[model samples]
Target: MPRAVLRARGALRRALPALLVYAGVRALGIAVLAVWGYWTGKSPHQLLSARWDSLWYARIAEDGYGYTLHLPGGKVHSDLAFFPLLPWLERGLSAVFPLSAGDAGLVVSAVSSLLAAWAVYLIGERLYGRRAGVALVALWAALPVGIVQSMAYSESLFTALAAWSLYAVLTGRWVWAGSFAALAGLTRPVGAAVVLAVWLGVLVALRQGKEHGERGEEAARPALPRMLLGAVLAPLGWLAYFAWVGVRTGGPTGYLDVQGGWGNGFDGGLAFGSFVAQRLFGPAFAAGLGLLVGVGLVLWLYAACVRQRQPLPLLGYAGAVLLLALTAKGYFGSKPRLMMPAFPLLLPLAVAAARARPVRAVLTVSTVVLVSAVYGAFWLNGSGPP
Candidate 1:
């Protein structure tokens, strides 16, 4: 057999178990969704590909940008606010295949979600071990909004890019890290987290290099020029989209205006703070407490991640993701979905899971899977992702 064949076999042997875990968890979520659909007379496929942000993405894919709809309240929802990469993919896939843009979007999301799982597993495997990696993927798949990974949203694609970019940074593949980070920027606004990870990792490497030089030791410094090249490339995708939005909308901060039209923008979490305050004293008192608990859990997990000292890339990416998701105004219900890509935050849980008895770990994950699946179904049946 060829040496390449041996390498391929080895890789597959290692990846098979993690992939099985991912597939099993994903199947459980889908099965629950299917049951819910049967009970409610809803179509799971339509729920995944034809609603909410998915619709906007499909329109952009089919018709291109420069489209806008004025709502009854004088708000303009422009396709410009929806990033271009997903639609571009939808368009290309539809063109080359016998599929509608909606179908293509679903395909893109489905494929990307699996790639994201694989990348996530690789990251965990590298940091801890294969068992931890498998647990990490299982935990991620069991997130309450993990169903979005199978939808036509860009979250899955952005996550895949972000995970791979972080993995690249961890492995000292500076160019690959930068390239994926750039693609991530094209995929979602939160792509900045990936860029931050790359830059932070590179900065740390440079500092370590200086320390090694001072001690007359061989410095394994990441190549400054390559890392710089990646850093430069990482922001171009997002910046290019912003520049295009600005030019098209005839405003210097056109992208900001577009996001504002949708009642989204960074307001230092004031809106979120007020939201929590109103909820606490209002009819939704329990809901308010739940929100408080959720916020606390997010923070606690982040603190645990830091205590574990996972890596610079993981910490930077997870911190930036949480900050953006928490601080962004409006879309309170979507916050959980928004935070879905911060897989690093699950490292602490994965580590714990890895140490548990296999049967116990499986049972815990299975219960979460069932809960997440039901929640996803309930969410889709009601006011779904925005």
Candidate 2:
């Protein structure tokens, strides 16, 4: 065979496994949701189109915010509860396609998810080896919360932005990282984590350079001006929204109040913890206990971060995600899925698996696939959040 042909074949050989894994996981998730819909006497398309959180996003896409829900306790303000980016994309797509607002959102999410998986592959390949990179991307694409990737949700969009931002940071493209982080902040409140992680990474790199006696002009460091520029740009999206909400509502606390109306306020965890504890110990459902365990796993991940002395980028991102998951009052049941963007938590395990034995790799991948399949089925059956 020609040298070029051999190289091409080798590249395909290396990439095939990851591609297969991604396709299998996604296909399985779709099938499960379809079957569950059939069993529940619901149309799959309707189930997919059902107004849920995605409804709010679709409304924002079609109506451009300015909607409120009145509750018994108080009115829920949703004008700024959701970021504008995804809905904006949905609105733009719907104009060209013969799709409903919700279907448009789902299309955007699904495409973004594929982009996210590719970004994960790029990051892993650069930081680790080709095999490890492939495995990491596959693992992320096939995560147990796989159903979210297909829904008209923000996880895929957020992951696409966050992964690319992190990859830029890893590659020392500080400005690109910051720009993406800012966009991500607009898409989801959790974008703050990416911003913090990037800033921390730059700081660590600078500090280490100074410590290595590479002082003055001799050090190969990014310009302070450029780094600062990126840092300043990263959170502007969220900040702008906050400012707008504050001004319109006549107070800076209006955003928090709006979230509170949905039974989601940050009250120092007393209320949130009690809610979780009751769910874990109550006769409500086993999913509640699952929620508590997920929280505990997050805590354990933080402990692992400390023990591993992981980079500030990873640590900061993980910490921010944990804070949001713990403090957010509403949707205790969806905490696990909501926290899916905290991808840094998987880095340590990815690192370990990269160095594990072949048998270990096989066993780990098998377990992940099986568990993700079951959970995906359960979630799609209307047993959990969409």
Candidate 3:
């Protein structure tokens, strides 16, 4: 066999456990969603493939952009607000196969989510150890919004690219890291996090090279040409899309204007703080408390990750994600899903699970998985993530 095939097989063998755990948790989430959807007279398939953002993606896939939705409240929502990569893939897939754009989106989501799980495992294994890798993937898979991974949304695609880009950065694969980061940038606005992380990784390499020391297999600075190329490629996807939007809207800051139409922007978390405070001091005390706790826990976990001295790329990406999630003016319910790509925040929890007694860890994971599954079902069946 070719050496590449052999290495691929070996990698698969090593990742099998993590893959299984990820698959199992995701399957449980989907099953719960399926049962709940049926009981509520809703189709799970429709919920996954045709609701909310999925419909917009499908519309963009079936008909090229030029769509502007005028809300009765005088708000104009443009299709240009969405990045193109997911709809591009959906269109290509639906054209090549006997699939609707929505089905193509679901297929893309399902496959990309598995790729994301694999990349998450590889990252944990690279930074910590094999057991921690398995734990990390499982923890990510059992998040309360885990059902989003199975939805026909760009989160799965963007996450797969971002995680793999981070993994490539850690391994010193400059070109691959930049290429994946570029694709991630094309997937969502949050792709900026991936680009920033890769740039930070490059900076780290440059600093290490100057110090005549290396970490991991990086014994010296990356080749100048490759490093430069990686840096150049990292931001092109986002810049290109933004430039295109600017040209289309005939304004240099067209993208920002589009986001403004949706009432989204960065305000350094002041808006989110007021939002939490209103709930905290209002009739919705319980819900507000839950939001406060959730945000606090996320922040605390990120602090733990930093204290643990995770790789610079991981820290950079997680910090960027957190900043965007907390500061962006949007639905608070989507913050968790927005931060979903910052898997490194779960490193502390994964390490804790790895250090526990086997049975105790299993029980803890099982309990969390059950709760997450039920919550996912209830979430999808209710107001639904915005």
Best prediction by lDDT: 3
- Quick one: ranking by lDDT, best first? 3, 1, 2
lDDT (Cα, 0-100) at 136 in candidate 3: 96
TM-score of each: 0.95, 0.88, 0.96
Clashes of each: 0, 0, 0
Q: Against the true structure, what is every candidate's RMSD?
A: 2.0, 4.2, 2.0
Better of 2 and 3 by lDDT: 3
lDDT for each candidate structure: 0.88, 0.76, 0.90
Q: How many residue-pair clashes does candidate 1 contain?
A: 0
Task: Give candidate 2 regions above 4 Å deviation.
Answer: 1-20, 75-77, 214-217, 220-222, 279-291, 357-360, 383-386
lDDT by residue (227-328, candidate 1, tens digit) is: 788888888888888888899989889999998888789998999989998989999999898999999999999999989987887898999999999999
Candidate 2 residue pairs in backbone clash: none
Best by TM-score: 3
Candidate 2 residues 190-240, lDDT tens each? 888988978886787677767778573346454666677778888887788
